[model samples]
Target: MAVFSLMLVVFSLTTGEFVVSGILPDLAAGLGVPLSAAGLLTTAYAAGMIVGGPVVTLLTARVSRKPLIIGLVATSVLANAASAIAPGYAVLLVSRMLAGLVVATFFAVAIATAASTARPGKQASTVGKVVLGLNLGIVLGAPLGTFVGQHLGWRATFWSVAAAAALALLTVLRFVPDRPSATTGPVAGELRVFADRRVQLAIALTAVGNTGVLTVFTYLAPLLTEVGGFPPGAVPVLLLGYGAGAVLGNAVGGRLADRALLPSLAGLLATLVVVLGLAWLGGGHPVATVVSTVLLGALAFAIVPGMQTRVITAAGAAPTLAVAVNASGYQLAAAFAGWLGGQVVDSGAGLRAIYPVAAALTVAGLGIALYSLRRDRRESSAQGSLPGGRSRTS
Candidate 1:
């Protein structure tokens, strides 16, 4: 129940973030702003999440979890409401950023809260369920918001998300329980984990591992229309398939992570490289493109839970700050993906070139994962040589 409530928060948050693209034309006309200016709303939200989540999380680390999430989600609800009623582009843009500010912090706390309730080894499975909300937002919430915007108005879409956020806040207040801090030392101490070589590597792995797949996804529409020979109309449907695969991958990935974190990540990254290559090679074939698209989504998301688990494991008792930073790293990688994809396209490489290029990047991530695993083994073997086989964190 608690985990589901958290999922609702993510669903609402992400819905608000993604629906901007759907309502871009309406929003531009409504606010008398250019469409390009309206598109900045998405960048604003990403900026808020990337910059605000970690700083806010660090500042509020001593607070109890339940009220903290409630506060953040409630703030998001109000921000969305503000967006719904905003009279100008500046107001709308700031409101979107406000709504985005809570995303990373909320996710970090929420994942930890959910994992705390999991039975022993099932932590990753629980985290996976929480992550399912994100994929669902891409699958259901964005489309629904877009429809509402088209039929009603762009402002109506914001209202819809505000309502969803309010509902999430209420349920979370009811279902989510307060958790005592796992480590009660000075909150600033958590910041030191960032300096640890293992922690840094884990965060880097997450950023690198996600970049390739996301770059492919960023250009998916063009890839489908130009390369796969699918009509523009089919793009949304294929995205739905991709989103569905993400949901399934989350389920399977979490279970695999719980069983073996590093090995599973290594295997998943290797597979993702292969799938991206397949996507590149078979993109012109309709059936092959469809199959490869779904597989890409699955393989890509299957790596997430394990990467997150790796961060938490490496952080030891200071996972919250580490997790927040890790999420920021992911957002940064996403920002980079768009730029990288744009660069590839502008270089006169055909749109089909995205897959192999992305695949090569995933290969780098795979190398990092294996290297991390090797270091883990070395540390474990060294621990076994000690008097009581004590584990090492740094």
Candidate 2:
């Protein structure tokens, strides 16, 4: 029940973050801004996340988990409500940023809480369940919000998000308990996780992997319409397919992480390379494009659970700060990937080129994962040779 509540909170928070992409057209038209200016709303939110994750996590490092989560959910409610009622583009932008701040803090804490609450050895699986909410937001919330915006108004989408956040806040208040801190270490000690080579590699893997996925995802609508020959109206249905794939991938990845972390991570990254390559090559065929898109979504998300588990385990006592930093890396990479995709489109390279670009990023991530895996093996061998004959890497 507690895990389910946390998932709801994350779902509501992530939905508020991603729903903007699906409704950008309506939002721009309603606010009397150009599409490019409206796109800045996403950029502002990412900026807030990049800044908020560490700051909020560090400030609340000593606080109990339950109240901290509740406070973040409350902030989300106010932010989305402000977004729904904002008088101008500027106000809406600020509201979006506030919403972003809530997401960064909320996810970091919520994920750690979920992992801590799980039965022994099921940390990654529990974290995966919580992350399923984020995937559902992308799968269901964005399209639903888009549908609502198209039929009603852009502001209605924000209102719906506010309502979801309110419901999530209630769930957290009702079900989540005030647990002890995940760490007894001070802020300085928590921040030292960055010094670990494995942690650094895991963070890099997340950033690069996310960049690969978002680069293609940020331009999925155009890719489908122009390259796949799908009408604009069909986008929601296609996004649904992608989201379904993501949900499946999240579940599978979590189970695999619990059993074989490194192999699963490597396999997922390699799968992304193949998926994106196929997406680029087969993009001209509608059926092929749809299949590739769904596969791409699955392979891309399948890497997340293993990555998150790897980071938390690697960080040892400082999982909260480490996870927050990882979240920040994801947001920063997303901001960069969005810009990179725009540049590809603007430079006459066309949407098809974006897939290859994404593939290259995944290849980079795969390289990092392999390096980390090899290092782990060497450390295990060394630990096995020690006097006690116990492997420290294990």
lDDT tens string, model 1, 338-367?
A: 999999999998798889889988999999
Report the C-alpha lDDT of model 2 over 253-365, residue by residue, as the tens digit. 99988888988899888988998888888999988998998897787788888898888889888887888889999988987988899998889987789999999988999
Alpha-carbon runs more than 4 Å astray in model 2: 182-185, 390-394
Structural similarity to truth (TM-score) of each candidate: 0.97, 0.95
What lDDT score belongs to each candidate, Candidate 1 first? 0.89, 0.87
In candidate 1, the residue pairs with backbone N, CA or C atoms under 3 Å apart (3 or more residues apart, or in different chains) clash, namely none
lDDT value, residue 208 of candidate 1: 93
Best by TM-score: 1
